[model samples]
Target: MPLPPDIRHGGNKACYSPMLDYVKLPTPEAFESSEDYYSTTFHEMIHSTGHASRVGRKGILEPSYFGSHEYSKEELVAEMGAAFLCGYAGIEQRTIGNSAAYIAGWLKALKNDKTLLIHAAAQAQHASDYILNRKRGEGEQIDEPIA
Candidate 1:
């Protein structure tokens, strides 16, 4: 996807472009291990779940600049979502600590607003469920805001 991001160094960062509806990931060789590659890929996939065609998340549809509050929140969701997916696949042990630390760093930067974690966890669960193709019952309510 996205030409394996810069054919040379193979992009250091993976991203999901909402406008283009594509996930840009680096080559597996660029990562320390296959697990790292898959974890990063899972993160981008979670970002894709926010596309309007999928979950219609405002943060994705509305377009926020990098480092914005919306962007940060969406990143948090993606990180947690990736963690959930990794756990489901029984590969989280290698990445969950990093994910938690990443989230904690963001939380600290955001002044440790406790509710942010709660909201992000809920949104991440929903996004992870979506990616796994798990549908809720017609009356079941699991639609949490993306930001």
Candidate 2:
């Protein structure tokens, strides 16, 4: 499938603003390669999924300091979600190592908490499902409880 229209634009950095419900991304040339640019954009797009209108993950809804536990966990969710999307889209190898290394840094800072990793991965899956327009289960009609 094609990228969401709003995510295909240009800038010098990529970010998701929950208040705006849109992703801002740098130009493809700004990154080492187009694949890297798409990878970063996918990360921000995952962040966008946490908006109140979507998956409604608390980290995006509530304010948290940059490096705080909540913020770090949210970062994990975005990275893992992006990695999952990349894999599903058949571009995983192009960015998996980089994504893994980035995720590892957050894991280290979180004190190597395996439980946190599990929770983040599950949230990531949900976010991926949301982006792909998948429902939690047939007729479930409710958000998955946040981890």
Candidate 3:
């Protein structure tokens, strides 16, 4: 929710703070394109959705170290959720490739468990739905292709 100054001189990452219930992302200038900026914001939004006050995903509620199973799974969900949002907004074409590479990196950390994508995708759909203010059984359709 807040585009705060980067901690590092030119960091290009973002984060969601559960304690403060907010997202902190670098400025738009840090990204190569507007699509990249929005995609990164969406990724952090998905992470925020996992907060205890929202969808209550354990990966976010619990403290999971980097590269841990929970951490990897959560990263996959956030990236996939961002991809879904990008597709819905008709901007996936600009960010899909980066999303795929990001997801692939997390998958590798998860030991390349193909099944995790399925599971993560389901959660991603839920996160995107929540973010979009859609209710369950309303319309589980995605009009745009994710990749």
Task: Identify the candidate with maximal lDDT.
Answer: 2
lDDT, residue 45, model 3: 89
Best by TM-score: 2
Worst 10 residues of 3 by lDDT: 1-10
Backbone clash numbers for all candidates listed: 0, 0, 0
lDDT of 2 by residue, 1-147 (tens): 113425546767678877767788777777997778878988998888777666679889898889998899999999999999999888999998999999998887798566998899988998888788777678765355464
lDDT of 1 by residue, 1-147 (tens): 111212222576777877787787777898987888888888888888787667657668787877777788888888999999999888998887788888876666556466887888888888888877777779874444444
Each model's lDDT:
0.76, 0.81, 0.80
Better of 2 and 3 by lDDT: 2
Greater-TM-score candidate between 1 and 3: 1
Would you give me the overall lDDT of model 3? 0.80
By lDDT rank, best first, the candidates go: 2, 3, 1
Prediction 1 global C-alpha lDDT? 0.76
TM-scores, each model vs. reference: 0.84, 0.87, 0.83
| Candidate 3 clashes between residue pairs 3 or more apart in a chain or in different chains | none
* Residue 33 miss distance in model 2 (angstroms): 1.7
Better of 1 and 2 by lDDT: 2
